[model samples]
Target chain A: MSTTTATSGRARRPKKPITLVGVDVYVITEDGIPKFDEYGPFKIEFISNRGTKVWPGYVSPDLMLVNWYRCRFNATRPVTDKDVDAFVGELGKKHQWSAVQKLWNYGDEAGFSKAY
Target chain B: MAKHVITMLPGEGTGPEICEAVRAVIDHTGVDITWEYEDIGLDCLKEHGTLLPEKTIKSIAKNKIAIKGPTTTPIGTGHKSANVTLRKMFDLYANVRPAKLIPVLKRPWDKIDILSFRENTEDSYAAIEHMVSDEVAQCLKVITWPGSVRIAEFAFKWAKANGRKKIQCVHKANIMKMTDGLFLEAFREVAKKYPEMESGDIIVDNCSMQLVRNPGQFDCLVLPNLYGDILSDLCAGLVGGLGFAPGANIGDNCAIFEAVHGSAPKYAGMKKVNPSAVLLSGVMMLKWLGETKAAERIEKGVDKVLAEGKHLTYDAGGTASTDEYAQAIIRAMDTL
Candidate 1:
């Protein structure tokens, strides 16, 4: 038997950390009424801001409880409750009160300060 | 010839029996292989308190090649899948499973040869799941640019090398605009590099229907983790079942060959399960090691045995035990 040490020929790529910047939340509705279903009602996009470049993050329907609209965004920087308050403030500007109520009800029911 | 050292993970249940049979048949091929035995799965969990031991990982890392039998993973509860863990730990990003018509065990499609390249790491297989509340839960599906690009590059290279004429990117991009869309985009970008190859994209649901309707239309398929996991099994069904399917998890540094089927704990020592899956996997390992002549000899040996219809195990519609079937293949190899 002959002996020869084996080595990997493939080159390794440098690992870079992807930073999560913001999140886009869209309440799916039919005829301006919020549609409660497993596939939708709330569609979320976790936007990533890698270095100075911004790219579209992964999108998924929040298929949790039909009543509760809660989603988590993993970010390189800490996401404070103040950040969520600002996000909710933006939601109030664009969406109807009834649609926005679906989000706020979570905080009301769970006795939390903000909708996350 | 330089003797190759390989990490041998004889998994669990019928894993040991099938691994033994494959080892015997591979030895018959006359390739110089020194197997470094390692423990994995439930038995290892009992002894080492983990399904995968550090020593086992070190062995595969050192050898850069491994052949494993089917390992049992606890369902719903207990530790995560040992197979998934190994793939993630080793960064075995590309999972290649080839389903071809074994002429002897004749099926509907005479020319069913579909090679599937699955993105092994990331996607939902990342297991990044959380319970938002008592009644609510979510599992994040991650798709990174680097992850997608590497897998696409790997698939295209593999297709070009293997003389595959066409390659299809299977995804649910229509519904998943960003995640699967990025996966499709990466595949298209990679396809541009290989101008000689024909490339196309299909929605995963449509691809599944097309596969069952007429499998011959597809040559090579590349998909993200979840879809690839599901569709590879479907491709296996085209020629035969999981019993005849062989899989290989390949990374830049290392590769692990295994049977796509699960370890049947119920049939552990019965010696009744078929050994073709693991045997064919061994053939793949031989080919990866550049032992082409030995690989072909083993393939021909297996084909000869199956064609004779005498020593097939229970899964293949015969009454022969696992050892009997393995012996038949070894006996057939002598003539070659």
Candidate 2:
């Protein structure tokens, strides 16, 4: 018993940290405009439809509420995927997401967040 | 030749009484076993001031096998359970409880036989609970990959050795994706190695329903600790109750056989409580020791006595005392 020490036989490596640049989600609505109700107060700059900016007030009575909206949210600091997931998940509790696109910054500084 | 040395913990309450009856039946089988008694549980608490004495643990460690009577864990006393302590000390990870139908007792169905493989030593049974707030308390449910794999391997090896045709991996993988998912995943990996045996899985809730509705369909069931604790008792109800249930805790180095039923302190010294459970546990001990002939003899004797319906304890609906019921088993052993 004295000879045995409390340690693992194998050498273990620590986990690497994750860097999250921003989070993007496509939220759908039932009866209202996506920008007014779904994308609550974040630095969401440009709303797009197949690569076209249909933002600021895209709500029109003639346009049917097909209920699909995609907005990109920028984080103040680099965050992990877990951080982005928590943000998106809390939003999901009230609003439904037809689809979610997470935009990551792998340190290339390609400026995908600045493209819009 | 020297007899096979086996450790015995007489336990508390009816544990000692029923154990004496079981010892008598084992004696009649004519197999030589030198009993090494150890004071544990309540008896040890009285003398040594601890529920599980160090000597008791050392004895079982040295002997490698033991048949124990049911020990009482005084509730709300803040002391850790002697059973849990012993299991953790030895890393006794696999808890095996067999629920076999007895012809004497009436049931919803007949010929129902099930051997449950419970992953001991983990799950909420680890007892890592904390007060989240004044109104709320929470317990951590822990699951590990190696714990799952070893129990799965143990279950499959038991199935292969015992000639069982199918094994059911019971879990709630849909809800507890991480914990039960790992459990089911390990079971699937181990099942692939046994080509001859049929392997499948069922969710815990649906598995409980299937057990009561159609218990005979299940051959061997493997599950995590919590679900196993619940479902094993449910299976026991299918074929009478705990009196007919026998349990075994299997580890790499040591194994302990025990009656899954409680030690009825109220019925202590009355000689009225049924001894079949512990006696059957002794049958399990004999088999574990490789005394297959003696094991079979005692099993048959128990069956014959129960089938005759002449000498059963009050729980089984007869007028016989605990010792008398044991004597009836012994009397029938002559034919075996």
Quality class of the docking in candidate 2, CAPRI style: incorrect
Q: Write the per-residue lDDT of candidate 1 for residues A47-83, one digit (tens) a residue.
A: 1111100113211111011211223232234454456
Please give the range of 10 consecutive residues that has the lowest summed lDDT in model 1 chain A: A46-55
Give each prediction's root-mean-square deviation over alpha carbons: 16.4, 20.9
Candidate with maximal DockQ:
1
Candidate 2 scores a chain A TM-score of: 0.57
> For residue B53, what is the lDDT in candidate 2?
76
lDDT at residue A48 of model 1 (Cα atoms): 18
- CA displacement after TM-score superposition, residue B48 of candidate 2 (Å): 1.5
In order, what lDDT does every prediction score? 0.76, 0.78
User: Each candidate's iRMS in angstroms?
Assistant: 18.3, 26.1
Clashing pairs in 2: A20-A79
> Which ranges in model 1 have alpha carbons more than 4 Å from their true place?
A1-116
Candidate 2: residue B259 lDDT (0-100)? 85
